[model samples]
Target: MGVLSFLRATYDLDTLDTRFTNTSSTPYKTVIEARGDAAASKERAAKWKSQGQPSRWNTPEFYLYYFVLLLVIPYMFWVAYDASRPTDPKYKLYERLLRPGWIPGRKIDASDSQYNTFRSNIPYMAALLVLHPLLRRLYNAVVYPVKATGQGSRPTPEEADQRLNQRATFDFGFALVYLVALHGISAFKILLILYTNYQVATALPRKYVPAASWVFNIGILFANELCRGYKFGEMAALIAGPTVQNSVLDSGSTLVSWGRWLDSYGGLMGRWEILFNITVLRLMSFNLDYYWSLDRRSYSPVEKQIDPAALSERDRVSIPAQAKDFSFRNYVAYAIYAPLYLTGPVITFNDFISQQRYKAASIEPARTLRYAARFALCLLAMEIILHYDYVQAISKARPEWGRYTAAQLSVLSFFNLHLIWLKLLLPWRLFRLWALADGVDPPENMVRCVSDNWSTLAFWRSWHRSFYRWSLRYIYVPLGGSSFRTPRDAARSILTYVLVFTFVALWHDIQLRLLVWGWLVVFFMLPEMAAGFLFPKAKWEGRPTAYRMLCCLGAVVNIFMMMVANLVGFAVGVDGLENIIAGIFRDFSGFCFIISASMALFVGVQVMFEIRESEARRGINLKC
Candidate 1:
């Protein structure tokens, strides 16, 4: 069995035994009633901000990113090509490299037509720059009417057409320029993003232009806002609400169901899935933010776990929407904002729209330069890391796993989490920088160090925070959350995990792997849950040193268990996981003994650090 299975069977899990809240709590009922329509809170527009409009877009520093891009793209092609031809030492090694994935009709050598060349891919270099102006014009037009009608009125046909005139006049011209200048672009890789962007631009309503452009034109982007905001999973459940369990099903029906899931969920085309989901799934949040902005009843201070009694008369959530009309352009731009379209720090519609005015602000030139430098450094770091080809390096070495010692493999398993961190870290940094250039302060994703998370809970809270917030704010709070007036039941705690994790896993994809991974996380989180149940008001440090030491040891074993579980569910295959488990018990080698000790020592140190920090933060008055 895999490490996770072994742990699952062996670990002595403590059940959270507590009194159940048999009836609905007053707090829960209040949240339910207050959710229907927002009570009039102070306009969010008048709220304070610390970032304070960092810099404007028009400065020369804002254009520094173009130079950085020029440097990176060539390097990407070089790395991809070089990885394909590992042994060959020569530059322009396409003749040796067997690159089947890249586009054809490209030439590097006269000897064979198959040879890949950067020379052939220069048009893409041109296309990246060329597409920007077209995008800007189209986006500006969509947002123009939206800002003009601040009262939330629908745009008139004349208003739409007047804005669409820019597209009408220039859409054909831009397409022609693109076709001629960058005709050789392909369907895969980076081009796929460009292709999606092109499609979005083409899909923008162009009533006066060719009829094809307006055929499947978008209705108001906030169609969900106009209607009640429904999350994607909720919508899916409602749509598949008619599904009934049948005892008459056979194994073939199970396969059929899998295929159906693949079709309906993300498996149809994975890139399209990424494109569709990151843009659309958050529409519920987008719609809700819009709803909250318009209706006063939507803002419940208690919903955020804040005390309503502490709320001031001028209380608001940042700002209310001042524009009379819904800017489909603004909404779409924020949703699919290119850099963050795939990897996200998910800025809500309100936050994004609020920052646009700063994108137009006249700021100090020095600040603009500083922002550019910092962004360039961040991009440079990502590019440098990417060039290392860490994923491929691991994949290439996987076949020779037996050659490495069991302890080495376990160490690898542990650091696999770190590897995943580096992979995500760059893209998130890139997303933040990309948005920041436009004066939008997308919230910092990794506040705590990636590898230094004190506990499993702390790690997740910082990891993809926007998604976590959505789960907590939307799913957890409505389901009674931890705000129970009565003691929480073990069953309810488990149910909270079920809803939050299943939603997260299914949100990523409806695959078994993700489900397993999500459950693994739930298992890790159980310690925190159980602690809450067992110690309702007890303090940790206030106890005897012997007790605190015992707690520290438990924390060590807990983190190690989680590391193995994470590796089993995510990083390694079943065989690898099994090998690690077997090694832990069967391997009598000194290295195995050594690694076991180090892993324990490391976790102990981390736990101590956490306790120290907690004590420091509490100013010696409270015990952790």
Candidate 2:
């Protein structure tokens, strides 16, 4: 049976007890009853007598894993070098030293650029990989011995998991690696620019010579800002939100829409995105920090017991112990991937670990081939849209389109939006399949498709699902789940939308001012939220036609509001209520009729294509 099947059998409360009872009536029943008790003295004695001690992997084994990972870095570098042939004159010497020094000269092409970049950073990566395990082992070795004597040091599984997850041993190493690599790269680029500028300065007449100091200062500032912003944004996003919550500084506008917009458009120097990123990063980092702190607590064995009631039913039902265990591995794997680290899929630790474990398992060739093909096709489609600049044009026009243009542009925008969604969704789906095929079981509630291809809202839900999951899990649940009272729920939901949208806006760093765009969007979503509360019992019953119409309408209004907000926000930065209201009134005609018509056509095409695809899959024709 598959992992999912195994988990179902193990956790299925309805059938599990019966199977145990039937297998050995007396002992099994006693064991089951004992397991149910919070503090089963008799059962504990029996378990101790029977099991003696739990087995664990030795320190050497742990070190070996790290060593293997370190070796893999070099191997990857070698593979890249072999795949990318350099045409430069220095290539022959670089190639000759490959077997000994494992270094290669740079190539100007894309492949060469990627390879050289990875190769240059191999030492840092390898150090990070090795240092984590080494420090962990050192901590264990040093700390355990002192506690073994009457001083009372005990190592629990939770503590070990915490240590593993925090990767406390390796964090500094990784930080240093990042710093060195980033600064080194920045310095090189700055120096090159400086040299170019000096050459230009020298070429000019002596009487009209430009000050190289000014050019140098600018280069220095640019490099400093880039590195500082990247690091500061990352650290703040990882660590700041909770810290600032209780501070006096936190009392400022809880709904600073305009401030957020200014932050998005104003560049990194805009305090909004930087501050917001810091807050989010801090929130995420809190989990790891909390888990690590748990290791220091000397609680009774009973405290170690998993409490399903403590967690929400949804989370409890979705995650199995095996999945949780797998997440530790996933955290390490995903953390190192720079792209995801900066802008996440916001995956749970459990999901990540499961993905890694599954990737390590066996896979079918045919299934792998199919996954590759799907990913390639999705990527190709995205490239085509990007190359044509269709999405960019629509996005640019969105804020200023008159009524007709607004309608027309919304339609065109839908296709581009669909392509973007497809790029994220297709690869994710393939990854999901790859995990399942390799024996990793996904959560039962994972969304499979845009709501029957009928609702734009559904499409939004299906696209970048990790964001939805994060919003629901972190924001919605904490405020109180859907059982919230009508007025309170509506208010909380709106606030949640504001927070989520603001976070997303800051995440993109489009401009410091664009944070207002997020706020405006949240304000618009308020109507939808109110509608949701008013029709609490309205079920989305997969009625494609009805949902599709609703979705198109929602999309049009959303895109229209977004465009106007963005334009005004960017132009004036975040302003007071009076200014914002005035700006909206002033730009009321920004929604052009042509744009509206274009948006209509775009939606029509998408709807038609969706219907055709559905029919093809089901082998049934549907008349338009």
Candidate 3:
């Protein structure tokens, strides 16, 4: 009775009981706080004849969830920490902390070289962020006053066009200078690539632009990697024979000197290839956006009278009313917009152009500052994790995993995924925060915590959300992704995922393992999609507890599958993942551990469900 009383006091179970017991045909309407719309979601629910909103704090299962979490979380961490500790006396902890001359930072440094590089470049990114606002202020002071005089309170359409054109020209010049300073002579190579893509859009017939642009841009990207950025004029040799290559190769020493000289400006000089993937995405954005605009088949219309601030997400990425905004000047500026150039929470060409003309309505100084604080906290958390946890180092070392228990190996893989999550989240947030402060709002790449997700479909939706959105608009939708009008064809949807992931895998790296990982992800989603169809909410609404229990069971399986896919793709290679799986199933004890772990995970999923319900009550349905 006491325990039941505590549970009753903690959760609004009465609301949930009423919701479950009632068989009302009419859907309940609640305020949609996320969109500030109360009736919209309610009407949509009614149209679909779907169940009403979930009750807030309605979960009665949370006590068990908390109890399981308390035990599992600490045990996992304890095992991971114990297992990862260096056996070598030479690599002393005191030395790692103090950094004496004898002790190097091999252990202290992140095992993942990419993250190490990012960590080292934090200062440079910060410096760029600082310098950008000053430049923006200077431009505004010079330009805004002149435009404000003729146009009364709000600028007229013609004046807005003139202002945007001038800004684009200035941005183009500045971007060129910035790229040259950052990448030295190699900046010309990037510009040439962009120029070629632009020509494909402008010179080709509208019918041919889509195929031509994709083929050329994707072709160039693969070629760039295959030729290793065409170092030592090898591309020239391959294309134009030994004579032209010899001419270019003869000046290698001079090129080296040039690179060294340019490196004085910043350490990242002549490393344009490192950031070329992001550039390629921007290239495609310009090409496709231009192609779409030429047909006047507006994905979202941008009429002269439409307030840019009031436009929805789709509208912001639509082509502007004036065709001149699609000029080479604007294209260059949008592609290499310094804030988003290094690593993007990608903004489409139209969105970038629109935001430049009128600052995003989302840009609030207080909100931006709060976001900065969040970034700082995340960075600090990552630092603390790195300082204490050496799971990444252990994974890199590739010691005898057989020696460690299944739980330890599981925890090791688990923490490594978390590290991957944080490392990515930090840089994306930093760059995005910079963009937000500069009055441009790119998509937030990481929304949900890595551990918070349960559904595979929802996981993809939230993780690297900008990239997901980009792929959806440019690739998925065009490839016949089922929206409201079209009925969902499972086969077509599966094929679409295959193609999308194929592009995604290759785009990340031209590696076989990533491709395999993508296939694994597709395979895992089959069961999830099937389950969603087989055991939909409408069918199980009467048996709420049973339905919740069933979902929790499914979520446990999903969590393991997700971990396996990610582990194979990012943290550990095929063999390492093989070891983890083999170790887990090698004995009866291992089997028992799996049973216990699954139960714990089931509880965790119950908690996850409630969390989403809580968010729904607040009118923030992430749909993930």
Candidate 4:
């Protein structure tokens, strides 16, 4: 009777206030008083008021800066063309520049040279410039809508900030470092070419003419800087004044005087001069521009508030069902030819989130056969175009044919870049279906449950997708599911950085030195990682202009870095660090400034095109 009475007292039905009704009068009164006090205190809290609306980060000033950087492309083309011109005194410049370095008695005039280097490279450059925008547009049109529609609500500011920080830390710090290191090792083979070039140049019949010698010297310097450490500022300083001569001997009087003249300039102009004159600068500038245009939008509160478990039972399918929808035909059509597949058009949970809601159609034999035949043809054509023997034959027959003549080199570089896209698109689609079918019990919100940074950080995630998903599900989430506390988050950040980048670095080859380099640079995202924990409220709202600008800057910087690295890798192989460093120190010039300006412009134009295309496809006007 006593127990029943207590139970009856605790279970309130009549009173609207459950707390008071469920408890004894004395305790209930005390609880009510405490609650009242807390509510009153909250009411009295002060609120901050801002003077005005927040200003947009994307301004004309930013655009102007970007525009100037892209000019490097045209400038490099101009320089190369000029160098190959009959009136350019090419051999005289070489003779003047490298008087005592190697061969001491030969002089050649640029005007008399038979090499059509500039003309030959036009096709390659045109391909890049045209293909980049076309591909971007195709991706935006085909893929963006599929991903954007039916996305979950965005996240709150705090949640978004946390995710962004974590992503930046892991992707930038860990993945970039590891991948670059691995790439560096593979790139090291370029060094053999440099060494051979150096030997051949020295053994030439006469000492190289001043202009020719200077070009060779610059190439060597580029190789050195990339393989080893050469500060941009220092290189810029040396380039301003041409006196920063290399060891390649010149065969002309004017070469020595010209070198002396170049030694005199000491300001930004001099640096610009050096950066602009080098072929590597063009490549670097282009890369930086491309990077700048990448998407950097953060999730909105609605989008972030996802729970995978909340999905209805019917919506949940086995891994087999998931994989079933992804036929070989769709795989190649969607994955291979898709322009975004080339270099990632930002992928979000939104892109694949709808798959869970639909039933896949039964396999169609005719469709499968058609796709298979098309895929085979495409592969066969590409293989023929990229054949090593074909490339070697072309190079031997026409050494001065520029990129086309060096078809082997061109194809290899293209293959490397393209292969990344293939890996991302094909594997990602397959793995996503596999994960779903396997009944892995995805979180209530499949989109939110998966690591957001996985798509953004690593090129592989953006390109080779199977491994990307595995890393995210198995590695990222397990370490610290979305909302992590400080210390744990930091540990996860560092470890992820080390693991991903290290894997990428080691993937190409297992070299200790390459590993060391990968480790050293991979931690670049540590600052962003630390910031995530420290400033939980600092979230990035999707400001298209700002995002584009930053991506452009980052891309350009990355490309420049890669170009220098590529040069060094070409000259020194895996252990070319010493040689790369020595070459830069031995030959400094004033071409970097021009390169920087040109790169900025190129990136700006590309980004503008992308924004325009995106807006046009969406039937919306860009807000300038």
Q: Report RMSD (Å) for each prediction in the order shown.
A: 18.1, 21.6, 7.5, 27.0
Sorted on TM-score, best first, the list reads 3, 1, 2, 4
Give the lDDT of residue 539 in candidate 4: 42
Candidate 3 residue runs with Cα over 4 Å from true position? 1-60, 87-109, 143-146, 149-154, 232-269, 297-305, 319-321, 482-488
Error of 1 at 350 (Å): 2.5
Runs in model 2 deviating more than 4 A are 1-227, 230-289, 292-334, 337-339, 353-368, 386-460, 481-484, 510-512, 532-624
Residue 560 accuracy (lDDT) in model 4: 34
| Residue-wise C-alpha lDDT for candidate 2, range 1-624, written one tens digit per residue | 676764444443212112111221122224434666766756545554443222212445335544654654354334333322444232343343232221233322211222333335445644543454455456557743222222323334444344444442243344334423444333233234334443433344533332333344334444444655333223343343655634423444333433333334432123222223322332343243224324444532235553322222233223433324423223333333222333343545433432332221123344344444444555455444333323323233223322222223333333433443444454344444433343332322223322133322343354455566555654456556543366776576667666666656645454556577677766765555555555443465556446545555655555445444544443334542234334334444434544534354345434444544433333222221
Score each candidate by Cα lDDT.
0.44, 0.39, 0.72, 0.33
Lowest lDDT block of 10, candidate 2:
16-25
Which structure is stronger by TM-score: 1 or 2? 1
TM-score of the candidate numbered 3?
Answer: 0.84
TM-score on alpha carbons, each prediction: 0.52, 0.41, 0.84, 0.32
The TM-score obtained by model 4 is 0.32
